[model samples]
Target: MITRRMLLGTMVAAPAAACAHSLTEPEYPRVGAVERLDPRLDAIIAPDAPIEVLATGYSWAEGPTWVDRGGYLLFSDPPNNVVHRWQPGVGAAPFLKPSGLAGPIPAAVREAGANGLDIDRQGRLVMADSGTRAIARVDLATKQKTLLATRYQGKRFNSPNDLVISRTGAIYFSDPPYGFSAFDESPLRELLFNGVYRLAPDGSVALLDDSHHRPNGIGLSPDERTLYLALSDEKRPQVLAYSLDAYGMPTGAPRLFLDMSEGLAAGRPGLPDGLKVDSAGHVFATGPGGVHICTPEGDLLGIVATGKAVANCALGGPNGRDLFLTSHDMLARVRLSRPA
Candidate 1:
């Protein structure tokens, strides 16, 4: 077993430009910096904490999920069509190959892999399979995959980008054409609109909303009463909060939670994408510059700037105090004062 501390020791001894398929060496001892915007931010993240680079050399790292039972962190590399597993004592290694597209795919297709990942209550690995254009579950023991939802109103989904499981066993996800070679213009696209959907426990699919141009990430509140959807569209990059009814369906009009138009105007690196909510209701959403920490009431707390285009984040570790971040080609970790 190779622990992070041991990896750090090896990193110091290796050449700075060493490029390995598994863990790429970092040029700097630490890759990025963190910013403390408000005093309240101190409650969650320590003021003097450093952001540690865990691994690198991924084509496009996204969809980080912590498996507490296995004591490992799993993340997706969409372009490579694989999922990598990172354990404190085991370093980083490929856990799944052909993660999304299992059958013959067109030659023009570029991205054919999974994106967002979550552990269901049954301890199964649930994934937003972009290549297959569906939500799937994988059995850890046998590596068998079961397609849970693939279509809405008889039309196949463009691509399932991100997903979150509610307390009631309901699955909420976003479908954008990101998997297509030309996005919406791709000839393989089936759905006319990008949608956010809910999959009931009984295997029923319902379209929550299709108004957003590009819905990339989806998360549920601690109480499962509010759903937060991140719009990756540059024209209207924002996070929208929708109130849920008793049956876990959206009710009334959705409200703007946080708008990143100013950040876009200032030329930040990323758009609104993957997000997660803490036990106290603070939303750590991947947005312009880094992960935006905001209150449930929509107050901007601070930003965890990775100095790169961060795609997604997950709370993990024994106490859930470790924040695993998936940036452009790098995977990083930061210990938080507050646990999720």
Candidate 2:
């Protein structure tokens, strides 16, 4: 069994070679394999498109999102507690410092930073601030930060990990123990179960599901009729799909979307974490070796293997066809045939 210290060390401890190298550039070649299982994948991903390493040297980079208004990509390096921005002509630079943990913190604490990020309908930056244990919004124009939700039923959340906003202004998020130094055993924990919740436009928080052992990534279908969640448990790594009603409440039992048991048993690098859906209803979930591309019905279509443990990805660019990935220590990108 992996102890808390061991898990934290595995995540934040940089390899000797990586620590010796410069953070401005990648240490390895920009190369990865694309496993094509269906012909339909050819229509989405170009056969010749290469995965390019944009930058490197981070202590667990995750939560990638694109700002269309600024034509830049923003992602978080949690262990470092900083957010970085990458653009076309200009390269990567720190956009925000103390990105997640605001005030004083213990020196031994780790993993205190922002995780998932998204742009709301108002163009404000919405973040799942694990350090703050709240879902907050940042106004780009004013640089002001405001807390959206902090507790459920008067109990403080363990940590808000990832979230997605609906067209109606409702927010769906997952509360997991990843932000805590000791994870589930952390004394800061309050809630009995890790839950997936919905913060409605009416300013009410509702529990959607608490069955997932370690809910991490979440996304909604293009039609907004289905909700997809990724459970980041090594023993039971999988993605589940739930049907939603007009009110956005889940209906009936969730269907098993994709399972990675075989891959995990084979010693693959990652578990189901963050995920996103395209206009075509294809799910691009970060799991196993890299990004797993599957149809809405859960049929595996292809895999984008970055040869590293990837955390999350976002679809953006001039036409929204550029796929930006936040791998373990590097930021990579790949061009898609069709726009996301």
Candidate 3:
């Protein structure tokens, strides 16, 4: 990724009604640095690689994923109820209007759009929809949405925040009350506890854990033997790993994968928010100070410090070597030596 001031400069120089219609690789200005904490990071990322800005001016951007078939990236702007598409040469554009909320949102709702996104085995876009309080599937070509799960034991979910799909067609996700204005205290909240759940292929939803105050991001190891959860709890910010059975069910208690209390204590800008695992098992998690790159054993190797709160990230590009990040208002990317 390279930095370019000329593209943004030209857009500013243009008259209000005169916008460029040409599609070319838009080189955006770069911000942040690759902070190497261990020599092992050299094998994953280039120490001098730049974090190139792809887009900006979003209202709480989250849930980024790459569409390999489309050769582009899609991310959420929750508060604005929009899903944006970003391409190498075209930059950012709205992919879906009313990305989650189709009508007026509840007065107490803070965010009313889709949060986390992933492609299922069938190539359909699966979403953790905070507005509809469910896990949904969207047809990429028609934009038709199908709500897969909205309730558990007859009670509506607080809000489905993030999700990951297993090879067996099962879906794992986290439910928190971040969509509500008062979070857990909001009147709109139905579930008494924030939970991590699994939706099996048979349309059954099972609770994995209900103790985490707020579990935000969910991912799986390359082998799908462990589930990695990122806790957004500021009081106990950390990443947790849970062993999974062959059926993709949690088989045991969770273990601490990485503790971020020290990073928070050091006055970093973000909490453990979203995460992803590379093919080689490295965990690239968005936590205190930015994206923390760690090993399977929970050793931090480096960080992609964005100087802002990064919400989510996705591995995409021609060879899945591009690390796309949704950093608050901006969308940025870093070229990685190792593909996800």
Top candidate, metric TM-score: 3
- The TM-scores of all predictions, comma-separated, are 0.91, 0.91, 0.92
lDDT of 3 by residue, 56-161 (tens): 8987789998876666778998889899887676678998888887888879987899999998866688999998899999988889999999999989998899
Write the number of the candidate with greater lDDT, choosing between 1 and 3.
3
Clashing pairs for model 2 are: none
RMSD of 1: 8.3
* Model 1 lDDT per residue over 1-340, tens place: 3211111111111232122223433443466667888889888987577888889899889999987666678899987899898866457899889899977777646579999999988777899999988999998667789999988988888879899999888999999888887777878877889999999999999988888888988898989999999988777889999999999998987999999888867877788889999999899998888889898998887888888778899987656798888988899988899787
Better of 2 and 3 by TM-score: 3
The clash numbers for all candidates, in the given order, read 1, 0, 0
lDDT of each candidate versus the true structure: 0.83, 0.82, 0.86
Tens-digit per-residue lDDT, 1-340, candidate 2 = 5531122120112342233233343343576877887888898896567898888889888899887666678899877888898866467898878778787875434567888999887777889988888888888656578888899999988888899999999999999887877777778888989999999987789999887778989999999999999988876788999899999999988889999777667666677888989988999998887898988889888888888777888998756788888888889988899888
lDDT at 27, model 2:
41
lDDT of 1 at 272: 87
lDDT, residue 296, candidate 1: 90
Better of 1 and 2 by lDDT: 1
